[model samples]
Target chain A: MIGSRQHGGGVIAFTFIIALLLTVIPLPEGLRFLRPDWVGLVLIYWCMALPHRVGVASGWFMGLMVDLLTGTLLGQHALSLTVIAYITLKFHQRLRLVPVWQQSLTVLVLLVLHQLLALWISRIIGRPGVPWYFWMPSVLGMIIWPLVYVTLRGLRRGFRVS
Target chain B: MLVSLSVVLMVMDHRFKSLESVRNTLSLLVYPIQLIVEIPGTVTDWLDESLATRRKLQEEVDSLRTQQFMQQAQMQKFAALQAENIRLRELLDSSFEIGEKVLIAELMSVNLDPYKHQVVINKGELHNVYAGQPLVDADGVMGQIVHAGPYSSTAMLITDTSHAIPVQVNRNGLRTIALGSGTINRLELPYIPNSADIQPGDLLITSGLGGRFPQGYPVATVSAVQHDPGNAFASVVATPLAHLNRSREVLLIWPGHTTDINSVVSAPVEASAEKADTEAAPENGEAADNHSTAADTATATP
Candidate 1:
């Protein structure tokens, strides 16, 4: 039964790679608002879909890679990402039942919280003040949440839910 | 297992600096992946650009043409200024260190996390880009590469909070360290006395005091200087001279000397350009061969 329902690891890893690519590729000036936090969006998708397989622990690991690549203080992204994963896992059942539009709104709030938490940690560690572009990915993440959710749900349904 | 891996990465990232080597290998492998990944976005951008109407396209073309013309005019002025600079370096018998043979590297990928300000470029150990090599645009110094990979490396821009550079006042050559206040387009030159002879418009070029950046490249210009009686030190605000966020191209300047070159050039190079420009990079590299030659021709700060 698990085999019937479970998505292949290759698909998941491929999606992860795509998410990494999305994070790096620059968005155009006009459509930058549509540029989601690719890493978080994918993590949210995977968390809601396969909470047992990947959760806070996995999120923390990936967040470490992001922090390393971005040259931030170690453990900064790990804390926030772990928090995000826990929050998503906590409400995932209800979130899965919610309509697509509301699901996106919920993800928006999570992303905003994630960003604010990172900012708070940054401040505590001696960095002060950030540009408005720092928050752009959150709003963009919200906008793209539906697309990510729908696409993954489609993959899930095409293979198993039916 | 996951937590342990993260702990390992965190430890490696900070304590041992072992991740830098892995990062280099991984980035070199990821280089082609980056190209493949960037293609769709590039195509989408091109398609959107081509979709513009004729009038809008014409307007864009005209504006671009005007911008090009202005840059051309600026380049002419630069040429003339460079000629004068060469003559002055000749007079002072100083070295010429500048744009020629400057390494050019493309931005490979920008770090994705919003909290950190950093970028990785396509240059690396093979290309002579190393940790602490100064990254600059045509205008001024931007940042320094912190982690050098085989084919790519991470550069911490001057706007990043952790990065700082040594700068000198172009007017009188007063030295100070400029700290990045964690914001692009802003840097802080802190700890100067309210009485320091720094004007609002003073240019801050590299002092070469840090043995990191080359001498004479522009760093920042004092945008606003406030000498507060309330605070012990002067509040000097400066904007970085480089338009880094907008620039996709950069030059990596390898200061040819390990010892502070200026801790010599404080002499007549300030008085003349020809003395400075000719003795720039090569002397810094090969001068280790003939130590007395360099010490004699250029004033040995001994």
Candidate 2:
């Protein structure tokens, strides 16, 4: 059991890396704005599932990697992710008892907050505001939340990660 | 605490640019992930190229041959015109136009945000690319380099809202600033007086007034001009000549690689500083404006 616990960290790390790659894959021009918030979704899931082991620092690290990969302002995603991770960690116990569909609704709200924070930072830095389509990804993130939660939960149970 | 740190980093990146080297180094570490992410697209592009039919290849070759013949004929005329222009400039005791040196760079990826018209190119600091260096395609001016990583660089297209280029009417030499309107096909010539000599179908060329771009490159064509007596400035719009969204390769101009290009040293610093300043939300435009003007005069004299 202790050995499986030790190996659980590796599984989390591997999944996070895969999420990062998914965030960067080139999308067709017509669907560019619809690209999912893969990294944010993955980090949120890990923070909820393994609150003690994965929290604000890990979220910050993943966000920084996304910022670098996308060539955006260095700490733009990091700051937002840290805040969301902290909020999720604070409520993990209550969140765990919630139903899957309700959990996705909560994720929708969290993703909206994340997008707002990023938008605020970019505006402060003088980037012109984008159109309504900029918010489309957050909606898609909400829809994909259940799939991400189910998959990560399956992996945790299969590995006896706790 | 993390938020404060982020603000500090943002300020440093926007103001001093002290974080550029750090960004470049971290980009090197992150290169493998980017490469992995790009593989599927690259493989598909390669497959498309390899699977092309022989008939298509033959047709393409024939068209290219015709283009080459036409270009050669034009080049013969250009060579004579250039020699005559040099002689006339010498007679007038004016500085000769030095031949520009350029290197080809391939597009790697694009920033997905439609608001920010930026693209990553395969060449970077290793290829002597610097921030604010002018970029062009075969048709016309495209944009300028804004960040040079170790192995890759980012360019801000002229259509980005924050970008502004100094241009003159190719026919009458009336100078004005062409500001990007965040639309791919259009630019705004703000601050043009109502009585300005611009008209539809006029050719706008880089004036070399600001020193970031070389003089006399075709930039755009005036598409509409509206004079409003109610407002102080006229509404002028122009369409960029470059294939901003479609071009696969771009030319990075090494200004004054041949002659004493006076603006080559200070042009990029002032230009990028202006860009960085715009990010800080600062309105201190006088110093950079002065610097560019000084560089412009220096270049004009030789």
Candidate 3:
């Protein structure tokens, strides 16, 4: 709790809300599949950065918001985010110690796992997959990970948040 | 625990429609987020419209004036035909059909999943939109509203796998069902017999058999018809006339109660004709059957 002591709940909430908004912003048709899972990425960052403050419940709540926005089967995103948050929290100390590039690799794997879980649920509910490109967001998330990580780290330092 | 709760919700929503109110309440929270996200696009569209060159605007106005004049002339003939139709029905002691009412709605967002052909529209219960209201664009029938919230509603396009529309061939009046093929731009007439009069270029319009959609809107044009000697049912596919992926605006139709429309519309004329028609009961019976069939076609969903 000492490391995250200065991080107000308000800042955490602001980040999550912004991330949710980013997820809903309309993208061009051709680039739709490549739209990164903003909520998933933000949840991962928070769970890894402040494991004690943000964990399974936060992920579950944000996942529900995504479901409401996209009108997918309710609880679909919640289930995936819960599992990812659990995994991230369990490995938070080790994940925090990794180099940025290595962390991106790990984040890529987590995102792919998140998508695979979502894909499996959609398949159960009988939604046909579009194409191989549907998984491209995991790759894009990996590419953007370093930038997000550095910016958030800078924000934390500047605000003296933890 | 949360996972199981969500599963329960999904099953309940799919099977019983118990979560409709829940979804609507949650959508009230979602409405603002949608508006905020749409602001940028709206501003860009506004800028384009306002910043257009005066010459381009003049040309557009001139062309639109000519088009309006032509359409108004055509509409005058249509109105006369409708009045004549009602008068003829009055003479025959049959019912009259009422014209449908429409509300203009703009598309807010398309569902991100390509598998689900659904869009959110700006109109909802506030505008008297309801579930099963048919939607159309400039070209033809687009889809129907599946969920109506307070300020917004969701429409499932004609291309969804679960959607089916009753259609008749314009060339021969052969009736069939056009089932959404889970692909945009195409619908399948799976059960049409090989001997059916359908061809590659035939036009399919709503037969008004389905109680959901009103009669006579163009649904699709037959794009391909493959008949095999060994197969009983021909493989027929048609392209939707509406710009399903492109249209930003849609017309929501209120198909007013069709049953007593004839008596309601011809009340004044009915006074004189009713007395005379009473003398010819057999003619009235035949005319009533024809009128009822027309009424049934407008309301019948199946």
**How do the residues B1-302 of candidate 3 rate in per-residue lDDT, one tens digit apiece?**
76677678767766666787787778787677777777887999999999999999999999999999999999777766877877886678754345567778999863444457888899988888887788999999999887788998888888887777777798977777788888888998887888878899899987555456676789999999999989999999999999999999899987654343334444434223123223333332223221133233323311
Candidate 3: interface RMSD equals 2.1
Q: Write the per-residue lDDT of candidate 1 for residues A101-125, one digit (tens) a residue.
A: 8988898899998889878866765
Q: After superposition, how far is residue B200 of candidate 3 from its true place, in Å?
A: 1.3
lDDT of 1 by residue, B90-122 (tens): 665654654423678877535444444677787
Q: How close is candidate 2 to the true structure, as a TM-score?
A: 0.88
Please give the CA lDDT of all the candidate structures.
Answer: 0.70, 0.78, 0.77
Which 10 consecutive residues of model 3 chain B have the lowest summed lDDT?
A: B282-291
Q: Any idea what lDDT model 1 has?
A: 0.70
Candidate 2 stretches greater than 4 Å from native: A1-6, A159-162, B259-302
* lDDT of candidate 2 over B172-265, digit per residue (tens): 8777778889888999988688988999999999866555777779999999999989999999999999999889889999766643332333
DockQ for model 1 equals 0.25
TM-score of each: 0.70, 0.88, 0.86
Ranking, DockQ, top scorer first = 2, 3, 1
